[model samples]
Every structure is written in C-alpha cells, then in structure tokens.
Target: MTSTTDHTQQPREAEEAREGEGTTGTGPDAGSGAWDDGLIARRAAAASATAGGQPVVPLLPAPHTGTPASGPDGADDDLTARLDALRELTGLSRPRVDAATLAEAGRVLDDAAARRRLSRRHTVVALAGATGSGKSTLFNTLAGVTISDTGVRRPTTSAALACSWTDGAAGLLDRLEIPGRLRRRPVQGPDGPGPLDGLVLIDLPDHDSAAVEHRAQVDRVLAHVDAVIWVVDPEKYGDALLHERYLRPMAGHAEVTFVVLNQVDRLPEDAADQVLDDLRRLLDEDGIALGEHGEPGATVLALSALTGEGVGELRDCLGQLTSERRAAARRIGADLDAAAERLRPAYVPTGRVGLSEEAREEFADRLAEAVGAAAAGQTAERAWRRNAGRACGTPWLRLWRWYEARRTPGTAERPPGGTPGAEATAARQRVEQAVRVVADEAASGLPTPWADAVREAAARGADGLPEALDGLTAPEPAPARPPRPGWWPVAVLAQVSMTLLQVVGGIWLLGQVLGVFTPDLLPPVLLMVAGILGGPCVEYGSRLAARGPARRYGADAERALRDAAAGCGRARVLDPVAAELLRYREVREQYARVLDPVGGDGARGRAGGRHVRVTELSTTGR
Candidate 1:
C-alpha cells in the first residue's frame, strides 16, 4: 500500500493555504493553475484518507508533475505524466514549432485537466449528431423522461443540457457550463439502485446546425466529455462533413466512442442489417475500428429510440463505464495520442549526426590555412638568413647593403609581399566556409526549422572572426631581430684579420717598388692570396651554420599561429554549435516521454503494463 506519512506530517491549515494560493473561483477561464491546485489537494486528501487502511494504490508521484507524492493509481499517473511531458516539450521547442500549430494540443490538455479535477467518479457522456438525427429522442429515452425537445425540427439543441443519474455532480456540470435550469436529476423509482449510479449524460447542440454558435457549443462540450455516442440515421450515416471533420481526425479516440445507427425502426429488418454493415464500412474508411475479431475498438450498435430497441445495451455500456471509473482517463489518453500524432513531425527525426572530432579538426586546419601560417613560417626563415648575413659579413659589404636599402623607395621592414587587403578578404571567405561546414554536419537529419536555427547560431558566432585573425598575424616592429649567436664574433674577427694581412702586403710591395725596404715579392703575393681565400671561406661557413636555427625559428612561428587560429575558431563557431545541439537533444527527450504513455514504444492504442489498458473501455460491456 502507498504511504502518506510524509504528507500527513504537514499541518492541515498550512497545506490548505498553499494549495489555495491561486484557486479562488472555478471560472471557465481559470486556466490550468486552478486544475493543478485542485488535483494536488484531492490527491493529498485521498492519500491521507486511505493511509490507515490497506490501500491498493502504489507509491507514485502525482501525474501532473513529477513531484513525489501518493497518487490514485498508475493509470492516472501515466495520463498525467504524458500530458505534462507534452506541455514541457512544446515549451522547449518554441521558435521551431509555432504556437498556432499547437492550439489543438493546448485545448486538449486544458480540457482534460479541467475534467479530471472536477469529478473523476462521474462518467460524462455526450450525445452528438447532425440535426434531425434523433439525438434528443435517444437522449430522452436514455434519461427516461421528456427533458429535451423532440420534433421534426431542422435544428435544435442550441444550448447543452445535462441529466445525472445521481447527485453531487454540480462541479462537473459547472465545468461544462451547463445552465442551472438545464441541469436535471433522474427521479428515484421503486428499483433500489440503478445500474448507472454515477452517470452524467449531456445532450449537445447539433453539429450540422446553420447557427454558428450551436456548432461552436457542440465543439466546446465535446472536448470536455469523457465519451461520445454519435447518433446517425441511415441517410446521413456517410455524410462527408461528419466523417472528415470529426470521425477521421478523432481516430485515436475509438475507445471512448460509440457509433449508433438511430431510426433503425423506420427500415425493414433486412434493410436495417444492410445499413448497419454499410455504416461500419464508412467508419472503417474514416479510420474508426470496430471491436471485431477480439480487438478492442469502437462499439457499433443498431438501435431505435422510438421503439426502444437497443437502449438497454447502451445503458449497460454506460453503467459499465461508470462502475470502472476509468472513462475520463481513457478519453484523456486518447486525446494525448491524437495531439502527439499531430506533433510527431516537429519533434521526432528520421536520423541525425553529432559534432565529431574529425569535423573540428578539419575546421581548425582551414582556419590555419586562411591565416597563411605556412607563408609566415617561410618569411621567418628568410628574415633569419638576412639578419645573419648582416651580422657576420665583412664591414664594407654590410655598409654598402645598408646604403642601398636607404636609397630604395619601398624597402622599409614589412611583414611579407602579399597585399594586406586581399589576404584579409580570402581569410574571411575561408572562415565563413569552415563555419558552414561544421554547422551543416552538426544539424544533419534535424527538422528543417531546427536545422535553420543551428545554422543561424553558427553565423552569429562567426561574426568578426576575420578581423581577429588579422590582428594575430599583423606586423609588430619586427620582433627586435633575434639575438646574435655566440660564434658570430669569432667569424667576424677572422675576416678582419684576413683584411689586415692584405693591407700590410700591399704596403710592403709599394715600399719595395719605391726602393724604401728590401722585401721578397713571394711573401707579399702569398699574403694577398690567403686573405682573398679566407674571407670567402668564413662567409660560406656562416651561411651553412644559420640554416639550423632559421628552420627552428620558422617551425616555432608556424605552431604559434596555428594555435591562435584554432582557439579563435573554437570560441567563435564550434562552441556555439555544440550548445545548440545540446539544447535540441534535451527537447527530443521530452518528446519521447510525450510519445509513449506507459513509457513503451508509441504504438496507437497500446498501454503496456498499466493497471488500466487503453483499449479496455471498448470491451467494458461486451
């Protein structure tokens, strides 16, 4: 048995105050807040009432919300949970699913909640049909009184009328908006107790009436009723308006529906049977299944209110429905099924893909390429070589190169040879393409609207990315030209020594020619040859040594630029795409919960493992 000790621990006055926060009046437009408060209060009171006894109810959360509380039964919980899931799913899918598309679902939930809160014990059944269909006659026969006007009228029943077999249904009648004068109770006879003790029969306005308000009234009352008996005669049984507008759309509501062939007494026995068979065929075409071959579906019966042919059978069915006290729940479940079927396209997908590692890596690579990382590395290597030559070459050559640079028109230290504007434009294009690729992959197989939303998010994230990348690669004072190596001075000194030897040799030769000194020509010539050969060798060695460090410096520059590019891509595009995907996943789960009632696959009319099955209503009086 379910326990209510935790709930009972709270003071009664405090609990009442909390539950009564927003439920001052039970008006027609009170909305769902009043229903929630009423349901909570009733469930709490019921739990406390049965706590001391051996209650059959199991410990479960309330149906409307997932809050842990004692509930009446699992069937009620399942219906409530599915309704709650649908509401939440609709909210989560906003901007993707328009509010206008979900108007039917909203009405279904509001009506179910209002009905469930009013009175679960009473089974509210509506008699609905076209004008001159003998619905009022059948209703009067069922109530055993002349309550409704019956004649050869073109249109009747502009307002709803109610007849309760027992008392204490004022709340339910009020919810249906039935006028006080129109509400009636059956007079007690010598029979001790009637079969239908808690039945609330409603006579609705004619659906095919010319008056628009009468049709609107029929629609409003039908939405709130627990079950409906569609009364049709032989001629109008296959009317296209009735089938297309009502029967076809409510195919999921077969369990709570009964198709009656009224005025059968007007036809011969053979003709009556033929009309009934044809009516069954028409129902089949409208997607309403009959309880044939042991399957639970709608109950079809041929009857005549004038002769009282099948009134007893219909009463027995209503009696059974009221005794079980589950018609309201079954009807609510069917409404949920119909609403969910309409919404399946928006929430459920054929298939989908996620943000993969390969996609991210490819995006990063494209960004690196866009920023010209390879070109930057090559430039760094060339810069290193030029700086090294300036430091280690002979002083005269270095001075001449500097003078030549000053003479040139556009020889100032710049980053590279490319046009800055052109490179920036190409980089922007690559960045945009990368963003689109990743966004498409992430949104694959999603609904068209949601996919558009994901792509929009990616576009927003890519804004200003090109300018950011340019800032990272922009030139900034040439990095102070890397410090000279320790061995550079040794090479410079060797070159200077070679120059001194050549100078001294030339002077000696000149003096010899002038007869000022007695020197050999061989020594002077040999010194001159040594200076020429040594200078070239030193310069060659310096060039060979600079290759290793230049390569290392180029590699470092490439790695730093690539890292910056990858970071910018992640911050701008990838992260936003991932967030949108996560949100879609969350809403999808909510849809799944709404799709299934007993948390099984959402097959129509299958409520597995529940105490109350979805198709049990059709089999109630068989």
Candidate 2:
C-alpha cells in the first residue's frame, strides 16, 4: 500500500541525487543542481559562447527526479497550495491569468482578502488561440488522450473541453460551463502517472472564426484560468494581428505562458527551424523569454500532435514542471498580481473621500434644521383655523367683525375662536422653502452618477409633505358650520336700522325736491342706503374670490411634495459604493489564497507542495 513514508522518502532521495549530480562535474549526470540555478548558468554560458568567446561552459543535464521540493510542480509549493486554497474559498474552479484580465482580478483578490471578504484557491490553465492553432490538439496531447475533437475542418473545436486528473474535479468542469458530453478519458502512464494529475486543461474554441459568441466564450474562460498556453501554427506564426493583438501585450505574463509552435510537420525542415528562431527572437523583443531558464520568460516548444514528434518531450516537460511545484506557486503569484491590479481602483484607498465625514454631518444637520424651519405644525393649525372660520362664521358675523375692528374699542371682532396669525403661516412657508433649497444644495457637487442618486432620494423624502400641507391649508368648500343663531340678531338689527334711516331720509329728500324739507336729511338718507348695500356686496364678492384658488393651491402643494419626496426616496446613493465594496471583497479573498494556503491530502497537493508566500515575504519587513 502507498504510505506517507513513501511520499516523504521520495523527495529526500531526489534531493540526494541532485546533490550527487552537482558534485560529479563531468558526465551527463554532472549538471544537476537547483533547477533554476542550473538553468541560469547554462543560459549565461551559452550567451558567452555565442559571442565567439572561449566556450564559457558546457550545458548541464537537468536533474531527472528525486528532490525535496515543496509542490507537485518542482517550483514553489507554498504558492500553489495558497492558490488552491483561494480557488476553494472563492468558489471559483481555478485562478485565471491572462493579459487582458489578470491585473484586474489580482487587485480584486488582494483587496478582498485584506478586507476579509473571501478566500482563494488553485490556478487554472486554459489553452486559447485561433482555430487550427491546435489548442484542442495540444489539450488532448497534454491530457494524453483524444478528449477533444480534432479534424481537417477549418474550425475543429465547437465548444470548450475540460480535462482534470483530480478526483471530484468534475465540479470544476461544471463551473467552467463545460458540458459532461465533452468530458474525455484520462490517460494514465506507467506507475499511474496520470496526464494532468494536478492540472486542469481547458480547450476553448478558435478565437478567430468561431461565432462571436465562441470568442466571447473563450474570453470568459480565459478570465478565470491561472495560466495559458497560446498555441500558434507555422503559416500564421508571425501574423501581426495575432502578435500585436494577443502576444505583445501579454509580455507581463511570461512566467505563466507556454508558447507552442504547432503543426510543424507542415513546414519545410529548415524553414520550421527558421520560423521557430524568429518566433523566439520576436518574443524576446516583446520581453518574453524563450526557455525555462529565464527568470521571466515563457517555455517555447515545437510540436505536432498529428506526427507525435515532440509530444513526448512536451509531456515530459510538463511532468517535470508539475513535479517541481514552483510552477504552480509562480502561477498563483501571477494570478495574485493580476487580481491585485484589478482591485487597485477600489482597494488602494482613494486619498480623497467622495464625501467627507464633516460634509455628511453638515448635510444631515441642514436637513434637520430645514425641517424645523418649515413650522409644519403651525401651518397645520393656521390652515385648520382658516377652514373653521370660513365654515362657522356667518356673513353678518364677518361683516360685524370687520366693522368692530374699525369702530369698536374693547369688543373687537373674533372668528369664533380667533383667526390664525399671519406670522405662523409665513413661518411655515419659510421652512418649506428652506427645505427645498437645502435639499437641492445637498444633492449638488456629487459626481453625475451620485448626484442623480441624491436627487432621486431627496425627491422621495419630500414626496408626501406637500400633499399633507396642502390638505391642511385647503379652504373649506362652504360654511358647513354656519355662524351661531346670535349672528341673525345682529344682522336683523343692522337691516332694520338701515331701512328706517332710508325711509326717513327719503321722505326728507322728496320734501327738498318739492322745496319743502331740508337737503341735509336727503344726503344722509342716500349715504346710509349706499353703505348698507356696499358691505354685503363686498362680503359676497370676497368669498367668491377666495374660494376657488384656496382649495386648488393646497391640493397642488400636496401633489408637488408627494412627487418630490417619492423621487428622493427612490434615489440610490449607496449602489455605486456598495458595488465597489463588493468587488473589493471578491478580490481580497483571492489575494489571501495566494498569500496563505491550507494543506491537505488533496489532488491540489499531488503535483508538488504549495507555493511559498513570496509576496508577503517581500512586503513583510516593509
């Protein structure tokens, strides 16, 4: 039975072999050492020799196996473990690393974790390119099976294909939107060396001619993968559109890249070599290294799945990469870098707050102050009085009151309880107007988007106030509570007195006209008659004038307030802030996974140990 002891012993043995090979300096076995060290030394010597200097150093053989490496890949295991952790935390199947999307995602993950929003997990590798670039072919080759369809058709791949060696990895396929029908058989080598043991390979449609939707599909998947394999063919190898549009811009992702020259069999032998060389040079110019030795370069390989010429070599290279664990960690690092970049806008802490604390407080205070000034209670009472007066007071009583105000000393007229003071009504109006101005000002100076939200909110808040106020201030329709019975006594007396005075005066006037009575009595009689009719007529006209607009004005005010408040309440000030917050949370979670990993006996750890926390380490002291 396989035991923990066996797993532990394997790395020790590998380390010993590496040391031995390093000491032996002579045969094919002499070159083995730290993978990166050997690779760097060889590259340096090669460079020197190419300059026509004395042969600087001989190329060394990479250590075959057996090392105390941390991850499944011979690289950094800590980072890989963290990536896996992050993936699980985020509920995302894998970490995506690509030129177009990596930076944004990296920033988001970092900020999310810093804010304790979510966790992160494993790095996902996706193969993407134009049709006939052999992405499916390469995926099948890497997976060691004929999982994806490959044929002579112009566009062979119709949908995305996903292959993973880890058990229960089927969940990931579902997340990637890969249908079960496309799931392929796993290719197991001797000793159960499963293809893609710890890796998930996603084969996407050709980005060139597939339906626009297919291209969208490819882009969507690429956004989530941890690494990418950009497959290209000889005929279109130097296509400016491909390089300028896809390759050159991706120079930042050199570490997580594998540039494959596929369908090499189609090219003449010498021509193929020339093309490969040119490709390498171009990549170098774009700041992408060509071999595994460079610190920040992609691994380049020529392969033909049709002929199987370079298939095994590529497989072995992948196996070695997986076995080292550092590749996985690097992948996580790359993903973290990308996620951090995406979240930068939100997470970096905008030095200038959109609304300062003092400003917010000031606005709130202004709102409260305006409400106070509106004197709503006073307005309501005044409105109630006005209606009551109109409803209860008789016309005679009103005329008597008006007359008393002008002529009486202690017995001044009152509208039953009394008229509402003008000061209170004016105060109420002032408060309402103040509220409107304050609301408008508070909503101003915000970003257009935010300002719109504030305006909507303010309108909502003020929605019903106008209506409520209008209802209170609306005039009574008619005198529902007519003046008391006593009012009739005053009316009768005034009428009787006026009639007697007119009769006496009219007789005197007739006498004067007949040259019998004095002219004085005639003038008094005429004046009394005019006064009696004029008072009643003026009262009737005044009521008619005040009735119509008083009722309508209150109703209009109510409607206006209702509409404004409704609009204000509906406004959303927090949406933009909340959305940004959520985005930051998502990214921080991803970042955490890259920084810290949870180790378990899961498929994630099969390739190598998890990646080291290089980012944290680098920033730790600072």
Candidate 3:
C-alpha cells in the first residue's frame, strides 16, 4: 500500500501532543514539569531533521499500491520540446528583446527544471484567498490538525505554512524556498481516515494584506506551487479585487485551478448552489474553462472549513487529485502557455523586407556619380583626341599641340598633366553622397530601430571604399587609337600636294624677283593661293575624322569607372545591409516556427495568436 504522509509532520505532532498533557505552569504547578503553550510550540518546531522517520503513515485500507511518481511521459515529452523551443527563442531574441522581458520569460524555464528535479511524488497545492476568507481554517481542517492560526484580525497569516504529505518531497519543498521553520506535516484525523496522501498543502497569507512583506511572501510562494485552490467565501466571491485582478488574468490556467467556495455552511444549500453557479459564470467570462484533463467545469465545490460541513466532498476530491499526481505538469503547462502568448508580438509579422532592383540601380548610379565616373569618361575622350592630334595632325601646322598647352589661371583647359589628388578628392565627395543615398533607400519604410540597424550596416565598411576606388582610377589607361580612318591617307596626301604647289610657286616667284628665268607670274601667284586655301580644308577634315575614336575612348572610360564604383558600393555597403536584412528575416521565420502551434494540438499548452507585455508576472505570479 502507498502512503504519502510527510516524514516531518508526525514527530512534531507527537511532541506537541506529549507536551499538552503536562499541567500549565501558570496554575501554580509551573515548576512541576508543566508545559506552556509557547514552550510546546517551540519545542515541537525544534525537532531534528531525522526526528520524522518514514514518510508514509497508513490511515485506511489503501486502494493504490504504488507511488504516482512516474507520471505519463507523453505529455512530459511534448512539454519539454516546447520548453526547449522557448529557451532557444529567448537566446535568439536578445538583440531586440529587453532584458527584463527575457528575465521574466526565463523564469518559466528555470522553474520547470527546478520542478522536475524536485519531488514528483507530492503535488504542491496552495490554499490562497483574501484575509477573513477562512483559508487558514480550511488548511488546518484539510490536514486533520490545527497547524495554521485562525484569526479575525485584518491579516491572520503572516507567511506561508507548508504541510507535505510524503517524505521524499523535502527536495521539492527546498526548491520552493520555504524555510524549515514555517514548514509542517499533517497529522492523521479520526473521521473514517481522510484519504489525502502525496498532497502538500500550503496556507498563503492574504494577497491584499496591508503589510507589504506579507503580500510579497504570498506572491513569492504562489509562483512555485503545482496547483491552486482559490478559497473564496460568499462575500469575497464577487469582490473585484479578487476577480478582476487575479481570476480574469489566469484564464489559461483552468486545467490545474479550483474555485472552492469556503464558508458555505452559513448559506442554505440552494443559496450556495446559486453562488456556485454565479462564480462559474464569472470564471467563464474570465476565460477559465470548467474542468481538468478531459473533465469539464471549474471544479467548483462548496464546503464550510470551520464546521466540517460538506468537507468530506472536498477531501475525496483532493484524494483523487493527489493520487493522479499530474498537477505539476498541468501547472508547468499553463506557465508555458502564458509565456508563449507573451512572445507573440515579436514573431507574428510576415513578408520579407528587401531593396527593390530599381532602387539598387539608382543607388549604384548615385555612387558612380560620387566617384566622378562621368567626369573621368569625358577627360578620357579629350585625352584620346589630344593624343590623336599629336600623332596624326598636320605636321606643318602642329596647331592641336600648341592649343593643348593654352593654360590660364581660371580656364577649363586641361593642364599639360592631370593632378591625382584633386581628382581623388572629387571622387571622395561623390562617394560620401552615394553612401547617404543608399543607406536612406535601404532603410526606408522600416521601423525606427530596424532602419537604424540598416543604415549602420550599410555604412559598416564605408571608410575604405573610396581609397580602393581611387587606386583603381589612378592607373586609368588611354583608349587605343581608333584605326586611322580609311580616308586619312588621302587627306594627308592632299595636304602634301597643296604644300608642293606652294613650294613650286614660291621658287618661281623668288626667281622672278631675282631677275632669273621663271614661270609666268600670274600662274605662280594663283597656285600659291589655291595651295594655302586647300591646306585649311584638309586639316579641318582630319579633326572631324578623329571624333569616332574620341567618343569611344570616353565611353570605355565611363564603363570602367562605373564598374569600379559599383563594385565598391556592393562590397562595402549593399552586401552588408542585405546580410542584415536576411538575418532579420531568418530570425522572424524561426520565431514563427517556434511559436506555431504543434499540429493543432492545443493539448501541449500553446497559446495561439495572443500577445501581451510581460512586465508583470502573470496573475499566477510566475
């Protein structure tokens, strides 16, 4: 037979009973081994760690043979997978999620691990209610012993008092952070032997206590319990402080929750039923379902804690609950549900964020302009023409060479040599402008924080890009001269022919002047005129023929510089920004998968499509 009585409570109970037999010291028998209340209570509490022997103390014929320590593993495995996903998400979202939010969600995982390591043998049930609700009395009555103090003052319970049903749950209690002084064990009662074994009951201080510490203690202990029995009386049942502040918020925890109407003995049976019905309606409005596992209803029960009236029904319910021993899992499951719900806002958005192709091309053009690509192309075209003029222009005139050196202080004429530093500076300015353009485009339409990240990413390696581009442009080579035009030889020959005529005319004219025999003077003078006139036309035609090569050189230079600038922009800015975007998108997808419901099986405690800030602990405290 399985007995889950606490190992620590029996010895204390025996010691207290032993001391109570002695006469009171205040009645003139004080010196004759008489025991006072304070001394007995203290002595009972001071029992050694080993004073309580075995955990189980039989109270009746046990129907169950084995401890319920081994619970169903299917739910446990499923819940573990969910928790694993939750932990992973917590780590992944650190860049965006605040520290406090992570800390709050993080506690669910920590508590889950702690609960698993602690005793699975005992179900930690808490009796929580406002002051004057008779929760303490109910706790003592449930344990079949008067362990908690019942009072009429505003706040009777100052701290949590725990009564464990079994011996092996000491580790579990320790994990709960309950001090040993405040812990107790239940002594068996005489009414047909109450059947509550493997149950750890706690009476919590009033949540609305005026003393901050008392309320804080209650809040702290409330976070660690496996199940909660909200002990509300007739008056406080409809209290807004209890319903609105606590019950409504914990709707997802309906599985492990119980709404018990304490002090129902004061109300007639029909009246009690009506109040129970009203409480159920309120719970329904709060979104708490009515039932456990597949069972339905809020599991509402009415009993008078002080009179022991209708208390048997409460005991039987506890007996079955303790025997099942899956309350811990249910409690953790509810915690996971709430945690998942809180994280919905971060992952719920869909669609990828990226720069359009048109936007990219425009940005590249801006970068090219910033690097002086057009100016460089034009300079290349002019330089090509200058080289052509030097190589194939009329040798006799050489006017193109002379014109190239026509330098003035403020003119647009090219210097005999180009300045590298001045060109680099111009390119640098263009690069700066390009950076702003690309960053702004990439960040457009993004949320403020994401936009900032995009801009930062775009500018990540911006400093080195200009220098790289400058190095590329510095070695700019002149375009190959276009194959000389097909008519270039004819033009050159015509010029030579015209010059010969002039030479012939000059010799004849000189001879005539020197009184030597020569051609007729009229013919010589006409030949000179024609030769001079034709020379100008031939030179003009040659310049015209050079235009094709000049334009080609300009286009080639523009292409090269544009390619270099584009490469610079891609390497330094666009690639990094794209990477950041992809990262954000990937994280969003991972979050979606993590939060997605598993096979539509809501049984695993997933809260679909709910979002809320986790600034405060859930109404469940943890």
Candidate-wise lDDT, in order: 0.70, 0.49, 0.64
Q: In model 3, how large is the Cα lDDT of residue 204?
A: 89
lDDT of 1 by residue, 1-622 (tens): 0001111111111111100011111222333542232333343354444655743222322343323222344444455556666665655565466777666667776766566566556888999999889999999998888899988767767789999987778998888889899997766578733888889999988999999999888887887787899999989999998988888776666767789999999999999999999999888776665765655567799899999999899888878777776667667666666665566566555464467788889888899898988888888888887887877776667888889888995876676556967878888899889888988887787766668878988999989988888888987785676657888888889889878877888888888889888968988878878887777777889989989988888888888999999998888888777766655665565555654444333233333222122222212211
Best by TM-score: 1
Give the residue spans of candidate 3 off by over 4 A: 1-78, 92-98, 151-154, 181-197, 268-274, 277-281, 284-326, 340-352, 382-412, 415-452, 463-553, 582-590, 597-607, 610-622
User: Tens-digit lDDT track for model 2 on 1-622?
Assistant: 0011111111221211110111112211222333222333344445456445544433322223223243333333343233333433233211212224333443333422221111112235778887678778778777777888888887788788877655555654665678888766568767664444566678888878647888878766765455678888987877776677666655545556788899899988998899999889877666554444433356788888778878788777666554443443344354444443342332222222243445444433433333332333334334544543443344456667678767967773233322455544553464355345544454343323333444455445454544443344345574455233334345445545545665666676778888886556548667557646754544454445444444454445444444443333223222333232233233333344443333223223322111232232223210
- Per residue, candidate 3 scores C-alpha lDDT tens digits across 1-622 of 0011112111111111100011111111213232222332333233323425832211111111122232353444444444544554555455655666566467776776567656665888888998788999999988878899987777888888889766777776776677899888887656533467788888888988899998787777778887788999998898887877677666656556678899988898899999999988887666666664554334678889989987888788788777766677666656765665555444433223568787789878977776677888888788767665654555566664466546433455653434967766766887777787778877665444456777888777687888887676665454466445566677778878888888888888888888895546898898888888877777777678778878987999898888888887898889888765654443443343333323233343433222121111111110
Error of 1 at 221 (Å): 1.0
**Model 1 bad stretches (over 4 Å):** 1-73, 95-97, 187-193, 350-354, 387-403, 406-418, 429-444, 481-552, 597-622
Q: After superposition, how far is residue 48 of candidate 2 from its true place, in Å?
A: 55
State the displacement of the C-alpha of residue 425, model 2, in Å, after optimal TM-score superposition: 33
Which of candidates 2 and 3 reaches a greater lDDT?
Answer: 3
- TM-score against native, each model: 0.76, 0.40, 0.66
Candidate with the larger TM-score of 1 and 3? 1
Q: What does the lDDT come to for candidate 3?
A: 0.64
